[model samples]
Target: MPATAGERPLTPAGRRVLEVASALFYERGIGQVGMELIAAEAGVTKKTVYDRFGSKEALVLAYLRARDERWRAFLDERLAAAPSPRERVLATFDALGEWLRAESARGCSMVNAVAEVPAPDHPVHRVAAEQKSWLRGLYADLIVQAGHGDAGGLADRLALLHEGAVVMFSVGAMADAPEIARDTAAALLP
Candidate 1:
């Protein structure tokens, strides 16, 4: 059974488990981490972790969902603060750049999760893909609002740059990938 929305309030112990799992998954890669290690890190029994999350896949879904919520909230807040469509578009780049600069930044967790789980039937992949698609749609909407004639093309170009920069940062190629993307985006904006 899935955890109910109302039951997401974490107890101290449950919070510890989530903290450990998130860190381990981000640092070590999801495929490499085991339930036992997560339990040990959280200082809880394996059963306790199981009780809260049901299974590893479910936990992975929860982790990606949390990340999706955080990024969306940040974007929404920035759009709200900006007075014009162009400012909102630029603010999106600024927010992404800030996110990229944070130490220990593992690029978009949802994208990472999808890469880890390619099986189309996997629940984690499904949730992650849905979140990613939602992000793409939101970007396309913003571009349209900004009066871009070819919003689809603009959104595709931005998505490519954004995702490419993330992969580049993940492999340690460029620390300023986001800035590069921002520059390119600013030049492209109508």
Candidate 2:
């Protein structure tokens, strides 16, 4: 019988494969990395990699999912320490800044993956879109909690600023994009 959805658990070796793939995929563009490279670096055979993830596309989706999970955890941790809803919203930028500077100075993994993936219907592309939408929703929820009217509009503006900052930072046009974004977000908050 075929396995049901979500039935497969990641074994230790599979987790290692994902960890290596996540790092390689982030450091190098997705297109630059291949299953063989991932397998070699992960100390697993190409067959093992395929047996674990089923396909390269599946592995890419797993990598993005893992990255997204870590990102959300990081943002939540930062937001949790804020004393106010406004600070919580601003803290999201702070969290992003730290993440970009320390973990991924190159740019957003999702955005980068989207650029490499040729098809809109690819699992990685869907995951990337969902990640952005999740961030926008988080911003909107915080804005509402902070007593802001037109939370959706505010969220859209803030999300745009966030995306702009990431692009600028990635292109070396702005080293302090996150801080700048935070300040601009403050002004947007009524």
Candidate 3:
């Protein structure tokens, strides 16, 4: 159910279900929320939820994919606005800061999903790992473009800072965690 072949377009009700599920899944842990609550919140029947996503796992996957898409779009926009590679690398942190302040109150959704689904082989857990791995690779690519040595090492460090900031900002109640991470990452650069 994680990867449906030639997935059909979401109907309006399906869209509503996804929207509601995304919120509930992010705010509350995936294990804490159920199909019944998602359906009730979206004003759709449980059958409609099943019809749209096939199963709860699929719905969870859909929610993770949708959020990942949005975050990538946001980061892309910020990266595009930067004129240089170094600035672009920093732009990632800036984007994260803005995204955290504006949209994410509970830290990274992927991180939360991983916490909720501890089984490494689970589809949800795999998706969450993929998201984090992608971010690390992104940093590596950006650092390479910036002419940094040991892009892999520095990228790993920077990615940790970014992720740590998210958790600290949300659960640790450190309001300026992103900014602190950004400064530390900038220092690591040059």
Highest-lDDT candidate: 3
The TM-score of predicted model 1 comes to 0.86
| Per-model CA lDDT versus the true structure | 0.77, 0.87, 0.90
TM-score of each: 0.86, 0.95, 0.94
How many clashes (backbone N, Cα, C below 3 Å) per candidate? Answer: 0, 0, 0
Candidate 2 lDDT over 119-160, as tens digits, reads: 888777888889999989999999999999898999999999
Ranking by TM-score: 2, 3, 1
lDDT for position 104 in model 2: 76
Tens-digit lDDT track of model 3 for 1-190? 1323247788888888988999999988899999999999999899999988999989989999889989999999999999999999999999999999988988889888888888899998888888999999999999999999899999999999999999999886799999999999889996
Evaluate model 3: give its TM-score: 0.94
Please provide, for model 1 over 1-190, each residue's C-alpha lDDT reduced to its tens digit, 9 standing for 90 to 100. Answer: 1232445666777778777887888778899999999999999999989888878876777666766676778778888998888777777777777776763377777777777888878887778768767767777988989888898888888877777777777678987877787788889897
lDDT of 2: 0.87
